[model samples]
Target chain A: MNPLKLVVVTAGLTQPSSTRLLSDRLGEAVTRQLADEGRGVDVHVIELRELAVDIANNFVTGFPSPALNAELEAVTAADALIAVTPIFTASYSGLFKSFFDVVDNTALTGKPVLIAATGGTPRHSLALEHALRPMFAYLRAVVVPTAVYAAAEDWGAADAEGLSGRIARAAGELAELMAGRPATSHATDEVIPFEQQLAALRAQQ
Target chain B: MQFGIFTVGDVTTDPTNGTTPTEYERIKAMVRIALKAEEVGLDVFATGEHHNPPFVPSSPTTMLGYIAARTERLILSTSTTLITTNDPVKIAEDFAMLQHLADGRVDVMMGRGNTGPVYPWFGQDIRQGIPLAIENYALLHELWRKDVVDWKGRFRTPLQGFTSTPRPLDGVPPFVWHGSIRSPEIAEQAAYYGDGFFANNIFWPKEHYMRLIGLYRERYAHYGHGTPEQAIVGLGGQVFMRKNSQDAVREFRPYFDNAPVYGHGPSLEDFTEQTPLTVGSPQQVIDKTLTFREYFGDYQRQLFLMDHAGLPLKTVLEQLDILGEEVVPVLRKEFAKNRPAEVPDAPTHESLLANKPDEVPVEAR
Candidate 1:
């Protein structure tokens, strides 16, 4: 059996960001869960902060830089997605949202995604549901129900019981959803053959 | 291969001087640029059509008609004439009129204009862009090929026994090239009609255009338009040059940094590395241009964008002189060597009339 390809997108702005920490933890948990099920996994991480300039440039120029294009292909070709972002002003950071904005709207349709976020306090926790979930839903991705939110306190004292448990449970859910699914073919980059395109236009006519 | 220049006809402030030319001066600058193209040995001069400000070439035929009067040999074309918003009947009549004025030195590239609001400005919905391009071009194709077109389509009022006036010159409709940055449907349409496919090779990386041109060639063959090598292909490029490569970069960096389309995005170096944009000596321009053939196979036309980003009119005219004198002559000779004997040149009115005389409409004859 082919190793399940997993892509983790971390949109934390600062170096040594807690959002990336949460992402690594989530990635490890998912790998552990899949390993427990006797499955091998291939994982890729995308640090969107490093690509912020490229993303902004894509907006202005209408095409991604080659580096960003590779990252976008990795995201689109994954069997499952683990997207984590730092919450800013009650939602995912603009950089996080902007990265997805550059992705083809239909590329994520039917993709299995596990959404997570980090914030300073637990009050912004529901941003995962109100903001990230609906955005993925709009893209028609199958968002895993158990979204992990790691507030700063959750990384220290509050992490004792509930945080680890949530991480395990969410990881398990994603592993179950992704198991036995073939790696996506990066179809977004494939040219739709001319005959089919013509037929489609002709059908509409 | 044919070498020419295409302009967005932007009214930009010269970043170096911080002075903007008035619209009248800018328009005259464009005319002067066209005259310079003819004076130089360039093969074609194409103007882009934009319905908004910051861009001035909204009336392509009107501009080309004026250009037609001045130039004798230069083939006047469009970077793109919007196939989505404008009425097909008007396009047929206007272009036929242009053909007459320019002595059949006319061809057009069809594009769905990129500006979103221009759709509603012409009473069109942006969502229907592709369908409008497909349906509108279908009607326009017939309006020119068939003297009396009886047509009905989704976007426009039906036409019954309507004949577009001033039929195409020499009983042959002007050649059409579909100019698209990314649309596969437009590529298919170009292949379906055995017309040309022009890749706007300036803004994006050549790898992206390689895929587009490769698909176009494959589909052109699939549609029985001869072998893929025989399919008509054109590419757009942008260059800035001087005697020394560093001087070229030093002079172009300000304009590249402040230009409207690609400014504030990628650095000048990265943009040059990532796209067909070359900022170097004449030799560097020639070397970079030759590599395009290695990627897209032998092509028919090559048009460069030299006048945008408010590189003062003097600078533009100098660039043209460099292009005509130094770059294109080398390219023309280099591209011709090792090129397949069977590959045809870009179609001219004379070639079209000679090659497919039977296809000309009866009334046109």
Candidate 2:
């Protein structure tokens, strides 16, 4: 079996964004789980704050910038994606959302996505289910069943053990999703039309 | 150990030169500041969203998605995602698309937004802001969790067996933080859903944010998500640093007085005294910020408003250097020392998703 490729996307631009920290932890957990499963996996992490120009330009022009083009390529090629954002109001941030507006509609077709968010309190945790999940659903991406939300209190202290366990569980689910390969019956289906099948069979006889 | 800087972008004139940086230049400077934050060892970067003049981050996700490709470790987030104004459906799809682009280092702070007229611009009413926030969020949650949703609400049109696409990365949605400066209703909303509550402690005194955070903590426990102490909280701050305390004050004073946000309203000294804006050496910033725990109790994330006040980009970069080298390290150590063993660190994507309850099967409504 081919190793799964996981990519983590973060919308935190500051040095201490909770979203990014959470995303990195998720990446680490996924990597560890894959390793434990004896399946080699390649992980890619992309931070959206560094690509400000491409994002801004793309929005104005209604087209993908060259830099965004590369990012789109990465998404299309990846096996799964982990996306994290901070909840703003009752939804995802404009910076986090605008990055996706430029991608080709088909880029995320059938891709698996893990959604997560960080907020100051637990109230906005639902933004994942309400705002983020539907967005990906429209894009035709296969979002993971579980969504992780870390309230501000989640990081109030320095307990790596608790945080790591949560990450590992999310990663474990991702591993399971990746491990269950979809059947590829279309490829094996006989190409001959129904009418042609009889003729082909007769000819073979 | 995540760290980064955020720019509340403004197109301000260089007071000395009488020349204003274009919106483009100012926006680019924000990116440079983010890079500098990362270069200096901070972990994440965020920008605010304002649709009006003097504010350049009208489209934050676009900016963050662009930044995603350039840096490796820096997480990109928004100081505000206008949940009150923007359509919830668009919000869901856009961030999910960004999730694919940036990999997974994305999260957002949801706010009702400060601007009044922006509501009409987006075909919404300011009077309906709270209800909009509640209703739209409810629908958004369903869209992310259920593969197909049938939702009918007062604000937006109903959804009949609709499915939002580009399934969230790994089938999990991005984390959410509800940011409120003075609205208890917003805090209540956050607590009701067990989300993070952010008090951007920039303008008001500690007492104001304290009440808000206190309410959130109390209600979080009421909802049975966790203990009040386990309620997630994030705070916002502002600082100006120099090697010498006196120099920091001297350099920052002129900019503070003339800044568009609070200019001519209060003396720079008075404003700093009243608000979380700290002006002095790195030690002063560290000391003032550490005291936040004293007022708000143990908290999860801390963000600084470094790039506001019309400060030049060069000066802002210098601030990041001080923050990375002198300020954050000390605070990190101090925060860790005081943290209790039973307390949990703030949630990240990993920690939040680790413990899973069985999925609730949905029936068509």
Candidate 3:
């Protein structure tokens, strides 16, 4: 069986962004949980701030930049994704939001997703469920039940013990999802042609 | 760990020789730095979008689409997707198109933007930035969620019946994080929606962000999304690291003092003291960053500003090497040893979509 592939995506533009830190912690937690579950996993994290300029320029010229293409490939291949961003004005940041606008719509089809956010205050924590989750739902991605939101206060109290527990739980959820039973349908099921059905019937006859 | 590098898009004078890279050179160099970030095992690469003269990231999707084709695992993101000035309908359409192009490794941050004058250029009023942000985002949200939406709001004209095509992958819309520096209202907005709140802790002191985050956590719980501790959070930071602490400071002080955004405003020492900017050795950066949890709590994501200040491409590449090889490993271990199990880690694609109680089929329900 292939090891579960997890991709953590973040959009934190500042030098020391809370969004990046949250993304990292989530990734580490998932890695450790997978290890504990006796399952090997490949974890990948992609920060969006680095790709902002290229993505932005590509939008203007009607040409996809080389960098954008490569990042797109990553999303298409990932088994699961952890998406983190900073809340701005009750929504995701423009930079963080715009980056998603460039991805191929089919990449997230049926892929499992975990939505998370970082902000100055905890009030915006719901942004993950109300804002981010709904967005993923529209894309047809399966969002995990629990989403984590870290406020500045949480960071202040983030002792080693406190932080690790959070990671374990989040990772545990991810592990369960990865180990959960696979859907019993194949891509061809929805597209069975009349002739193909007839042929199958004749063969059965 | 979530490792990646971000650029601030500054056309700076080469301090050593007093020669500055042009804006175009600086922009292209930022792209090279992004690719290099991926090569060195970083997870995500994001850039800022500024329509001003000193910056050149006006079209984020265009550049990210290019990068998406080249790298294999690197997720692409944006620093700011202008919600105040840009039309929500266009935003909905554009991002949907990109979603199809980049697969699903896409998410974004939305903001009113820092520049005050940009409002006029886009036929908007600066005074109404807050209203514009709220209304625009509401529309953008509907555009992504509803297959066919008829929306009328204060900011944009009513839509008779519009559908944003290239429907989100498997019906999952891109994730979002709301970023703010000084706006509590934005934080409230994020909480109201149960979205992510991002505090770009680069310019302000920890206390300021702390207050905002505190309010968000409380409200998040109030809204019944989860306990405040369960809310997702992320932050921003800037660093100039080298093997030697002294050398790191020596090399970065001039750039810190002369760069456009924060140049000549505060002494480097004062800036670092008050803000998230750390211009020193990797250890110093790590030390300062770890302290963040002391003020905030066990957060999820952390990103660094490495390729700014007109630093040469060569220097930026070197920075990524240090980050991937040295700083990240220690931080990962330290952070892991610290997080709490009940607290919940940040959300991921798998975790978010797990155990989704069987959807009530439209017909059966």
Which has the greatest TM-score?
Answer: 1
- Which lDDT tens digits does candidate 2 get at residues A107-134? 7878778899988888888899999999
Which digits, one per residue and each the tens of the lDDT, describe model 1 over residues B111-141? Answer: 9988999999999999999878878887888
Question: What value does the lDDT take at residue A130 in candidate 3?
Answer: 85
Q: Of the candidates shown, which would achieve the greatest lDDT relative to the real structure? A: 1
How large is the interface RMSD of each prediction? 3.4, 25.3, 22.2
Off by over 4 Å in 1: A158-160, A186-205, B358-365
Model 3 chain A lDDT-worst window of ten: A184-193
What is the TM-score, restricted to chain A, for candidate 1? 0.90
- For model 3, chain A alone compared with the true chain A gives a TM-score of 0.81
Go through the candidates in order and give each one's C-alpha lDDT: 0.91, 0.78, 0.75
Instruction: State the lDDT of candidate 2 residue by residue for B1-365, as single tens digits.
Output: 34556667888876655678888889899888877877887776878889898789898888888888787777777788888888888888888777778877777778888788999999899997876776677667677678898877666777888888877776677777899887887787788778889898887667778988998888788878889888888888889999998998888877877776665455567567667889998888989999998898888888888887667888888888889999998888898885876667766555546754645566633
True contacts kept of 3: 0.00
At residue B334, give the lDDT of candidate 3: 91
Ignoring the other chain, what TM-score does chain B have in each prediction?
Answer: 0.97, 0.95, 0.94
